[model samples]
Target: MSIKVGVIGAGGMAQYHIAGFKQAGAQIVAIADLNEAAAQAAAQKYGVAKAYGSIETMFAELPDLDAVTIIVPNKFHAPLAIQALEAGKHVFCEKPPAIDAAGVQQMKDAAEKAGKTLMFNFNNRARPESFAMKAYAEDGTIGRINSAQAKWIRRTGIPGFGGWFTNKDLAGGGPLIDLLHMVDLAMYLMDYPEPAYVLGQTFSDFIDDKNFKGPWGIPDAGGPTNVEAAAHGFVTFKSGQTLNLQVSWAELVKREEVSVVFQGTGAGGKIERLFGTDGLDETSIDSCELYTQEGGNSVNRSIVTEPCEDMGRSRSAANFIYTITGEEKPLNTPDQALSLMKVIDALYESAKSGKPVAC
Candidate 1:
C-alpha cells in the first residue's frame, strides 16, 4: 500500500516537501495551514485531494494518513509534531528542530512515547559529498575527527530587514539558528559527540540595514529586528572533540560561503559551497576535498560527485518517506536534534552572559 501523507504549512518550504514525498511514491492526501485560502491554493496547485485550515481537522478527517511533513515556523514545530505523533503518525520536520531545547525535548519525548519515527530536514547530510564523506569516515579513511570549523557566512545576505527571519520570537536567533546546516553537518561528521561547554558572542552590526538584505525575494514584514546579524562560537565535547561555528546573515565579508572543515587523525577534509550571487543557490559552486600525508608528502585530493541543485532538500524529504517504509534509515534522529538545540541554547546564553556556558 502507498504511504499516505499530509503536509502542514502552505508556505514555500511546503512545496519542497510535497514534491519530495511524491518523488518517493507517497500519496500526498492533504495540505493544511492556518490560512484556509492558502491551503486551498496549495492543494489545488499540487493536485492534492484535500485542504484544511488546521492539522487537527486533517487528522480528524484523514485517519489513514501514514505521516505528516511539517514546514511551519520554528515556534510551532514542537506542538504540531507532538500533536501528529500523538495522533499516530510519523513526522518529518524542517530544522532548527524548535525554538529551544525544552521544546525539542518535549517533541522527542512524544515521539518516543508514541513509538513513531521523528526526523528533521538536515538536508546537507543528504548531499552527494556528504554521502561520500560519511563512507570515508565510517571506513576510517578520515580517521577520528578531533576538531572542526563550520561556517555559513554571507557579505550582504540578511533575508529582509524586518521579516520573520529577523524576528527572534518567530524565527529564534537569526543566522546562527536559521543557517545551522554546516554546524549540524560538522557534528554529524564527528558522530555527534556529547557537548560539554560552549563559549560564544553575537553581533548586530547590520541587523537594521536594508542595504544588507539578501538577494532572495522575501519581502520586508515591517517590524523590529531583535536577533543578531552574526554569531561566532566554540564548543567542547565530553569525548575531547571540539567545533567552531561562524554563521551570519549579514556581515562585512568577501562573498557568501557555506563550508565545514574538519581535522582528523588520519586526514582532514572540507566541503564548501561558494555562491556567485548571495542567497542564490543556483549560482553557487560546491566542492569537497581531503588533505593528507601520502608517503610523507602532503596531498590534497578533490572528491567529485554529481552536482546538487537544492542541496538535498528534496532528497532529504524523500529519505523520510523511505525510512518509514523500512527501506532506509533516517538521515537525522530526534535525539540529535535535541542535542543540537541544547548547544544552540547554551551558545545564546553564553553570548548573553559573556561567559562560557555548560551544555
Candidate 2:
C-alpha cells in the first residue's frame, strides 16, 4: 500500500522533501504553510491533492495521512512533530529537532504517547563519503578512536543577519545550529559519545563588523543582529574520547569547507572534503588514507571508494514512510535527536559559563 503524506512549509528545503517523497512512491496528499499561496503553489508543483494555510486544517481534512514532513523553522519543529504524532501520523522533522532541551523532551514524550515514529532529518549521514568513514571506523581499520576534529568554515556567509536566521528567538544560535550538520556527523561517527564535559566559546564580532557576506539575501544596514557568526567547542566523552569542533560563517577566508579527522590508538584516518546538499553537483571523495605502525614500519593504507546507498532528503522521507508501515526502522529516532540536542545545550551552557559542562 502507498503511504499518504502531507508536507508543512513551502520553503526551499520543502521542495527537496517534496521531490524526495515523490521519488519514494509516497503520495503527497496535502501541503500547508502560513502563506496559502505558497502552499497552493507547492501543492500544484508537487501534484498534491489538497493545500491548506495551517497544519491543523490540513490534519482535519486529511486524517488518513500516514506521515507528515515538518519543514518549518527551528522553533516550530518540536511542536509540529508532537502534534503530528498525536494525530496518529509519523513525523519526519528537520534537524536540531527543537530549540532547547525542554522542547526536545516534549517531542520525545509526544512520540512515546502516540506510539509513532519520530525522525530528525540528518541527511548528511546519507552521503556516500560519510558511510565510508563509518565503515572504516567500525571495522577497527582506524583502531580505537582516541581523538577527533571537525571543521566547518565559510569565508563570509552570514545568513539573514537582521532576519530570522540571525534572530536568537527564531533560529536559536548562529553557526552552532545553522551548521550543526557537521557537528552531528562528527558525533555520530564517533559512536555517539556521551560527553563527560564541554568547554566552548561563541563569537558574534563579525555580524556587526559591517563587512560580512549575508547568505540569507538580507541587506546590510537593516538593523542590529543577535547571533554568533562563529563558534568552537571542546568535548571530552565519557569513554575518554575527545572531540574538537570549529564552525564559522564570517571567516576571513574563502570557500565553504567541511571535514572530520579521527585519531585512533593504532591508526588514524581523515576525511578531507565531502560535498553536501548545498552542492550536489560537486563530486565527492569517499576514500580515506590511514596511517599505522605495523611490524616496526610506518604503513600507509588507502581505502578506495565503495558503493553506498544514497539517503538524501528524499530517501529519509521514504524511510519515514517505511518505518510507519513497519517495513524499516526510522533513520533517526527521537531518542537520538534528543541526545544531539542535549549536546547542543551543553555547548551553549559551557560557552556562557566559560567552563566545562557535564553531559
Candidate 3:
C-alpha cells in the first residue's frame, strides 16, 4: 500500500514536498496551514484531497495518515514534528531542526518514544556532487578527513528588510542557521564526529539595509531585524577533526558562493556552486573535484554527475518516502540533527560572549 501523507504547510516550500511525495508514490491526502485560503489553494493546485486551516483539524479528520512532511517556519519545526511523531506518524522536517538544540532533543525524544522515523531536510546531501563526495569519503578514496572549510557566502543577499527571515526569534540566527547546508554537508562527509567546542562571531552590518536584499523578492513584513547578516565559526571535534564555516545572507564579496572543501589524509575534494544570481540555484554553476597525487605528479579529477537545478529539494523529500518504504536508508537522522543544533546553539553563544563555547 502507498504511504498516506499529510503536508503541514501552504508556503512556497510545500510545493516541493507535495511533488516529491507524489513522485515517490505516496498519496498526499491533505494539506494544512493557518491560512485556510492558502491551504485550500495549495490543495487544489497540488491535487490533494483535503485542506484544513489547522494541523489539529487535519489530524482529527485523517486518522490514517502514515506520515507528515513539515515545511513551516523555523520556530514551528520542532513542535509540529513532535506532534506528528507522538501521534505514531513518521516526520520529515525542514532544516535547522529547530530554533535551538533543546527543542531538537525534545523532538528526538518524542520520535524515540513513538518508534517513528524522524528526518530533517538536509537537502544538500541529495545533490549529485554531495553523493559523489560522500562515496569518496566512505569508500576510502579520500581517506580520513582531517579538516574542512564550509562556506555559503553572498555578496548582497539578505532575504528581506524585516520579517521572519531577519527576526532572531523567528529564524534563529540568520545565515549561520538558514544557510547551514554546507556546514552540515561537511560534517556528513566527515561522518558526523562529536563536536567539542565552537568559536564564532556574527555581524549585522546590513540587517536593515534594503540594498542588500536578495533577489527572491520576499516583501518586507515590517518586523524587528534582530538577526545577524553574517557569521564565521571554527569547530573542533573530539575525534581531532576540525571544521571552519562561513555563512552570510549579506556581505562584501565578489559573488554568491556555496562550497565545502575538505582535506583528507589521502586526497582533497571540493563541492562548490558559484551563483550567477543570489538565491537562485538554477542559475548557479556547480563543480565537484578531487585533488591528489598520482605517480609522483599532481592529479585533479572532476566528479561529474547529472545536473541538479533545484539543489535536491524535491529529491530530499522523495528520500523520506523511499526510507519509509524500506527502499533506502534515511540520509539524515534526528540524533545527528540534535548534534548539529548543539553546534549552532554553541556558535551563537560564542558569538555573544566573544569566547569559545562548548558544544
Q: Which residue pairs does candidate 3 place in steric collision?
A: none
lDDT for each residue of candidate 2 in 248-335, tens digit (9 for 90 to 100) = 8887654567777778876887665544422332433344577889999998787676544343556666667677777776556666
In model 2, what lDDT does residue 74 have?
86
Q: Write the per-residue lDDT of candidate 3 for residues 102-192, one digit (tens) a residue.
A: 9999999999899998998899999999988998888899999999999999988988767788888888879999999999999999999
User: Which scores higher on TM-score, 2 or 3?
Assistant: 3
Model 3 misplacement above 4 A: none
Ranking by lDDT: 1, 3, 2
Q: How many residue-pair clashes does candidate 1 contain?
A: 0
* TM-score per candidate, chains pooled: 0.98, 0.89, 0.98
lDDT for 76 (candidate 1): 89
Better of 2 and 3 by lDDT: 3
Cα lDDT listed for each candidate: 0.92, 0.76, 0.91
User: What would the per-residue lDDT of candidate 1 be over residues 233-324, giving only the tens digit for each residue?
Assistant: 99999999999999998898899999999999999999999998898888899999999999989999999999988898888999999999
TM-score of 2: 0.89
